[model samples]
Target: MNAEQALIAYVLRLADNALILGQRMIEVVAAGPELEEELANANFALDFIGQARMLYTCAGELEGQGRSEDDFAFMRDEREFQNLLLLEQPNGHFGDALVRQFLFESFYVHLLDGLTRCSAPGLAEIAARAIKEVKYHLRHHSQWLIRLGDGTELSHARVQASLDDAWQYTGEMFVADAVDTVVHESFAGPDLEAVAVLWRRDVAAVVEQATLALPGDQAMASGGKDGRHSEHFGFLLAEMQTMQRSFPGATW
Candidate 1:
């Protein structure tokens, strides 16, 4: 695809990741381990959803379409979403959720920092605004990762298992395709190869502090960038889009 199309697709990929993860977090709104943690979970969910709104709005502008962010979010089919397979994974437990957040945010923080300098004016502006929130997200998740991993033997074991399960999904984050190459090469987008280097360093530091071992490189699960997703995505989309599908254009 051309540069413009590639950029549009790139923005949607960002939006989908934030949106899906936000939905996953919101699933634990009233089920957090504690009251304060529940509040934090809700707040983090809003942060991601807010990010998604901005991204979807920008994608709509880039597409030169009349579609609103709601339409892009609520009216899309499961296969149409470009979110990473990692984000769509089920939130199994408290530790599972934290591990997922830490891994994704570690990479996301670097990705946004690079986007802030991209040639696209809109993307740079959005990245500039979003990176501040992402910094906190990384810190929050990273701290929890260290806590759970270094805490009790039980906590350590569970979190470590969660990390291992999530490790395979992490590979897709740095696998650049035509969409990534066109955007980075022509549109001054983030070099994902470089992002991968930073990701490894950041993740390794946390793993070391937590007394956890990094999993070996294994066969990577991919295809979310190309609108392919795991089995969980359909269930997520069904719940997320039910209202819009049931009542087309119905609004408060």
Candidate 2:
């Protein structure tokens, strides 16, 4: 792919991850254990949706097509989405969701940091704007991870199990594919190897502080970048695209 294509792909990958995870969080909107956390979850969901819009707009422009952000978002099949597998994993319980976001936001903060220096000016600008929002997102999730991990024994055990169950998916985030390679080599994007090292350190520190055990590194699942998504993605898309799919042109 050319530089622009590579850059758009990279941006959309970030956006897709955010969007899918945000949608998952939204599923628990009214179910948060506390009122303050409910508001925080809603705010974070909107932040990811906003980022998704920005990325989709950029991708549409780069594609030079009549396609709009809505088209790219609601119309795509699960197999066409490039989100990380971790993001698409089901939100099992409160603890499950919290640990998942904690794991992702920790890595995403650094990813956005690297993106701020992208060779493409537009992509860099997008990343610069996004990094601010993601910083807060990382903080929010980190705080929850600590609270739940260090809370009552029941809470700690549940969160620990959540972390363990979700751990395998974490590896996919660092596995650089062809598109990522092109972006890094040609466009000064994130160095996946370096990001992985830093991610491990940051994650380990947080887990240690939370009094949670770090999960062992093992075989990682892949295929999101190559358009293969988990079965859960289809259900997510079905819910997410219901209105657009059923009505075709309905709007507020």
Candidate 3:
């Protein structure tokens, strides 16, 4: 596509990742294992949602089609979403959620850091503001991952399994496609290959600290960047979009 279209797509991809993960975390809002963690979970959920809002607003402006953030978020079909497959995967348990967040946040933080210096001023500004929050997010998840993976026998096994299951989905994060190439070449956006290297180092360090084994190399599942997703994505969209679909234009 053209430069503007590529930019819009790039922003939507980022927005979709945040929105989906934010929705997933909200599922555990009051169900966190403890009171302190419950509040922390809610706050983190809001952080992702807030980031989604900023990206969607930027995308809407770039598209200049009169679409709002709500429209992009609530009005889109399941197949139209461009979030990572890993983000849409079910948050099975406490460990499952933490592992998922840790993996994605590891990559996201670097992506935002690179975007902060991109040629696109609007995207660079958003990235600059977002990197701060993402840094905290990465820290939070990384610490929890270490705790769980190095905890009791059961905790260790569970988190290790979560990591392995989640590993397959991680491949998509770095597999740059045409959209990514255009965005990088035109807007000076993140180099996915470079980001992948940093992501792996961070992940390996945490896994080692947690006393967990690094997941073995295997066939990587992908296609999320192209609007293709895992089966779980449909259910996520059903719940996420129900209100707006039922109410049409109704608002608070």
**Order by lDDT, highest first:** 1, 3, 2
Off by over 4 Å in 1: none
TM per prediction: 0.98, 0.96, 0.98
RMSD of each: 0.7, 1.2, 0.8
On the 0 to 100 scale, the lDDT of residue 102 in model 2 is: 84
Cα-based lDDT for every prediction: 0.93, 0.87, 0.92
Better of 1 and 2 by TM-score: 1
Residues 1-252, candidate 1: write the lDDT tens digits. 889999999999999999999999998899988898899889999999999999999999989978899999999997889999999999999999999999999999999999998997499998988889889988988999999999999999999999999999999999999999999998889999999999999999999999999999799999888888888888999999999999999899
For candidate 2, give the lDDT of residue 32.
81
| Candidate 3 Cα outliers beyond 4 Å, as residue runs | none
Please list the residue runs of candidate 2 whose C-alpha ends up more than 4 Å from where it truly belongs after superposition.
none
